[model samples]
Target chain A: MQRVNQTLGRIPPWLIYGIAAFPPVWFFWLGLNGGLGVEPIKELEHRLGELALQVLIATLAIRPLREWTHVNLLKLRRSLGVVTFAYVSLHLLVWLVLDVQILSEIWADIVKRPYITVGMAGFILMIPMVVTSNNLSLRKLGPKKWRRLHRLMYPVCVLAGLHFVMLTKGFQFEPLIYLALILVLLAARVPWNLGRATA
Target chain B: MAGRYKSDLKWSDVTPKADWINRRQLMAGSGALALGSTAGPAVASLGAQKTDWGAGLEPNTVEEITTYNNYYEFGTDKGDPAMHAHALTTEPWSIEIDGLVDQPGSYGLEDILKSVTLEERIYRLRCVERWSMVVPWVGFELADLLAMAGVQPSAKYVAFETALRPDEMPGVSYPIIDWPYKEGLRLDEAMHPLTIMATGLYDEPMPNQNGAPIRLVVPWKYGYKSIKSVVRISLVEEQPPTAWNNYSANEYGFYSNVNPDRDHPRWSQKYERRVGGGLFAKQEPTLFMNGYADEVGSLYAGMDLIENH
Candidate 1:
């Protein structure tokens, strides 16, 4: 565990950001090259949403991973969170500009569709977390309030999972598996009282 | 297969070279006046028919047709059918036509084709998923096939069932929406000229994923209403249990017509992204009955579509 921590600590945060930035770039390249299949916009939107969820899941795992394995990824958590927000925003933008492309229908979809409503809720909740992600806001709000505010991730994850589940045609198991994983992670944080723990 | 027929015969030339040879062999062997007499007028009319239903829209590329599909029995993903459906055994296939039909029995695909004529029908396929495509399907009208089976007056609906082979279809393991996918149409809708039994696409035999061997294509309704890899077709009095309706009664209806006004419970049907139109392509406004209302609208003239849907 000590050796793992030492190795992780040695890696620069910039390197982590560089590695994390690859997916969106690769996905865009694929989009430009006709690699996203027949319905490229749908594929692009789906991929962005999936990446956002994956990054969120990874960000949520950082603390638990440190507690269990003693290999701290605390330094990269903020980067992961920022990347997740970026992907989520891109996902929304694609749906708004490229996919739907109608102002009235977009509003109607977010209001009418249960899945999109949940997804928009998640995105809305993420705004505060993204706004106060830096050290300046962290210092201004203090550690206690910041910790409380950040705990909103739990509900955000649930909403994201629900969005995924409801988007599918029938009772698909894939989205349910993601929801289960999020629930297990959330459960792990409960007994430890890690919500109060500082990064 | 016999030599390829000349191209100058127009789209109405339903007599493929192999069928012509088979007809000659049957005539020489048995002197079957009964079969010839019955088939003569139908063949003659088919030969004279020339219909361009696509209006000027070019058919989607063969790559799109072969790759993108919605055969849920194969899997839920669009690409799943293309990957997994090749495991299906399409040869030696037969369809069981029963219920209110006079001649109710398992009929071989070859025998069925011998009696019917194949025509090129360019159709706009609007999926319930809000994606659309134009496909040039090669087959005959479902009404002709129903007539061949001799539909009774008691038959109010036509129920179609896809073949189930859990061993070959990996999607069946998930129990997505029951084993064999099923769909139904009102007797009038079934008899509509737009409802066809598609055997080939892009002038080629259908790829396994695209419901190879035979499938139904109802242009007026959502694509799911057109069941794939049909193994059984029954003319019944009651509306049969459809797969999607059985899965989610509120979301999927028995009729499932392509109406832009009636949004799906989860998503809007007002607009559809045309497949192969690239990422930045604007979504087209969905036409009522996918633009086939001019021909099929009278079928539901008295019924409230929203209530029926």
Candidate 2:
């Protein structure tokens, strides 16, 4: 137990990669167990939405939790953002495989469902973050350019949360709580220059 | 006495001991149980109670009477009863039946089962929140027990409560939903042929979260109306308050009818994704009254369904 605690005290980047791989592990479990029932595609779609929401929330939570609790989980930040990308990709794959079972139908759903449109936009915006998350890209882009480029996460989180809230037609209290938490976390990170100094 | 109870059972054909033990262990720890087919040996072990009535369902190897469930002490979740109800002292279970009943005393679970001639009924369970299951319930009609108890004409509705034990059901420690879950149906709904005070399922006694001794089942209504782990049954003149309504009045109304046309503000009620149906099975269109309209439709006649719903 002491050894385990000691190991946890060290921040391994592979740990982030391992944590990032869990959505696929869960997807595999769902596939193996026949847990998805008749709606594997639909379940897959919902799973993506949930995973995206979770990753987005985790990404938004990093700065606040770090400042408040002072635990440097910063290594997890980029990886969690990538996991969000992976989940969103899987969500899109299910649509291709089960839903529509055809490309035309997939295109039609993307056009018809406004929620899908917003989700697609969120996924599209995430490509740059995932591309730039690498150490190689960080060196080429430099800290100033990389930080500015990653600012896209804010609108992506907003669109993703809104996509979830809008898709749920009734009063789903759980999603409301998620939205509230994300807003507070995001609000806490407002730029200093944006606020007027009190005289 | 144990031999007499076990007379109908064939131990060899019982559910695999390992599986039953594991399930019992899991169910003992969890307050709710999952819905699935049970093996034969398990059914035989659970089906030992003497009963003159034939099970309404065709007995199958994997079919069992008492399914695992997850109804937390505070409320029912599909998985709750199996996960959180081990500490519930169901052995000394007693139900207080009063108000408009000639017999208004507490009754024990053992006594209640012995008195009723348990029958089997296969019914499609439609949850108000929009999931469904086809269950073979092993118990007499609620009216048979109510008639024996002698309900007065003034008894308009029947209200049921689950015993609230916080120490056993740790979920109650947090206020997610109301404790001591309550459900009600019109007297007519209670006495419907389809409605049952289920004692067993698949062939065994109900697990603790499945409402061990007794629970209500109104097939026409959403699953919530079928209260589990019942501790009280009171016949009232006015429609009493129900659990879901208390939680969200606008979302879950008192008359939570099974209407395919009336969509939940959040989701479509036009169709339902059956809980156990495998992939590629099209979501079956939800029926107006869970396909029990012929039996229960007349009961609500002349009343505005939109208003009540």
Candidate 3:
């Protein structure tokens, strides 16, 4: 675990961002070229959303990994969160521009559809986290306050998971598993967080 | 009970389980979607005379119609049916026709095909998932099928059932839906000329994912109303159960008629994207009865469609 931490230290956190940036481009290229299948817009929209959820899961996993395994990937967490936000934004853009393609349905859906409401709320919550992700904001607000604001990710993650669960037609297990995994990751941190606060 | 619906099926008869998956990967590798049919027979292209139905609308490409499907017996993903359906053995298939019909017995597919005259119907299929497709189907009318069976006066509805081969259909193994997917129509809707039991598209034999052998195609209703891979047709007095309606009674109704004013809780609304319209295709306004209201609107003249939905 120490060796893994050392290796992770040497790998710049920007490298994760750089690598994460490539998929949206690759997926967009696929969308343009018919590689995303017959209904490329829908596939592209779903793929981006799934990627966002997976990246967000990776973000949530970081603290647990450091606590349990003694492998610190603290630097990569912020980068991963930023990447997740970008993918979420892309996912929203695809739905608005390509999939739905109507301006009226945009606000109407968020109002009418519970899943869309949850997803939009999640995306809105991400805005503050993304804004505060920088070192400037970290220093301006100080670590304690900055950390408190960023814990908004907990609700964001929950809402994102709920969004997926609600949108599915049948009782699909995949989205439920994602929601379960997120809850587990969040629950695992509660004891450690309480212990640290008391200490 | 589901075990009763499982046919003697093996992927080995089509292509080795390992090989069929590889075939999809290979097709996916070769540019776009060259998938969906390799596991089944070499599609025989027929040259049936075209009908005036859906005359002005351009039919979507065969690839779009076959590759993007919602045959949940195979899987829920639109492409799932195409990817996994080819393994189904549709040849020598038989459907049990009973319940208030004069001739109540198992009828073979070959015999049914021989009895009915084939016609090309290019119809717009609006799915409950907010996507639409125009398909050119070659098959006979359900009214004809009902006529051949001789419906009794007591029969007020026509209930349909999809072939449930758990060995072949992987989705059937999942508890997502009550197995042996079912659908129904009022006797009048069943007898409507527009309601067809499609055997093929693009003059080719039905692709497995698109409901091979014989499938219902109700142009005026949401695509799910048009059940796939039909194995049973019963003329009953009471309204029979439908797959979506059984899954979620509030969301998916028995009528399931396309109404632009009606909105699904999540997926549907007044708008639908026409597949094969390329990326950034503007969503067209979903039509009432999917633009077949002129012919079939009187059928539901008195009922509240939104309540039914």
Highest lDDT: which candidate?
Answer: 3
Higher lDDT: candidate 2 or 3? Answer: 3
C-alpha lDDT of all candidate models, in order: 0.81, 0.67, 0.83
- What are the candidates' individual DockQ scores? 0.63, 0.19, 0.64
Candidate 1 residues lying further than 4 Å off, grouped into runs, are: A192-199, B1-50
TM-score of each: 0.89, 0.71, 0.91
Model 2: runs farther than 4 Å from truth? A1-22, A34-50, A61-82, A89-152, A155-184, A191-199, B1-70, B74-80, B279-281
Instruction: Name the TM-score of candidate 3.
Output: 0.91
Q: Flag the better candidate by lDDT, 1 or 3.
A: 3
Which ten contiguous residues of candidate 3 chain B have the minimum total lDDT?
A: B1-10
Which is the better candidate, 1 or 2, if ranked by DockQ?
Answer: 1
In terms of lDDT, model 1 sits at: 0.81
- What's model 2's overall lDDT? 0.67
When sorted by TM-score, best at the front, the candidate numbers are 3, 1, 2
Candidate 3 clashing pairs, residues 3+ apart or interchain? none
True contacts kept of each: 0.78, 0.14, 0.63
The candidate with the higher TM-score, 1 or 3, is: 3
